[model samples]
Target: MRERDIEIYLRDEVKKIKGRAYKFESPGNAGVPDRLVILPGGRVYFVELKAPGKKSRPLQIAQQKKIASLGCEVLEIDSLQGVDEFIAKVCEGK
Candidate 1:
């Protein structure tokens, strides 16, 4: 599926887990993850949605590392099963 389709599916699944997923945009912050997802209990995750069988761009990977360095979890999702597993893991919590 396309990146947008995966994003929509993941956002809908997030809602089922009582979370909110917002399209992330930042002025002058190119390569940032596509979505900022916040779950119950203040857990937060940044998601970069990609087309099936695709990988993140170099700059995208750099942005993910930058975000992770600040102590937030970042997820790269490219499939329906990835979204399902992400939802389940988030709901379960760590």
Candidate 2:
């Protein structure tokens, strides 16, 4: 799916689970993924919506690697179920 489509999907999915999807913006640009999702009870995460069959943008890839190296969680999703799984894992601490 395209990035815009992914954003809509994520926004709706977050709502379904009572979480809030916050798009992380920068003054010039946000090289990271399009959003940071925060759930109730202090659950939170980063998700980059890379199009299906397309490679991640160079800057996003670099940022993701950096975030990983720093011990942060970044989840990439394609289908709705993947988003569901991301929330479930974050909520369950699995």
Candidate 1 colliding pairs: none
Predicted structure with the largest TM-score when compared to the true one = 1
Compose the digit string of candidate 2's lDDT tens values, residues 1-94: 5767867888987887788999877666547867888887776677887666666778878888887788777877766667667767765763
Off by over 4 Å in 2: 28-30, 91-94
Clashes of each: 0, 0
- Please list the C-alpha lDDT of all candidates, in the order they appear: 0.92, 0.75
Candidate 2 Cα lDDT to native: 0.75
Give the TM-scores of the predictions, in the order they appear: 0.96, 0.77
Q: What does the lDDT read for residue 2 in candidate 1? A: 86
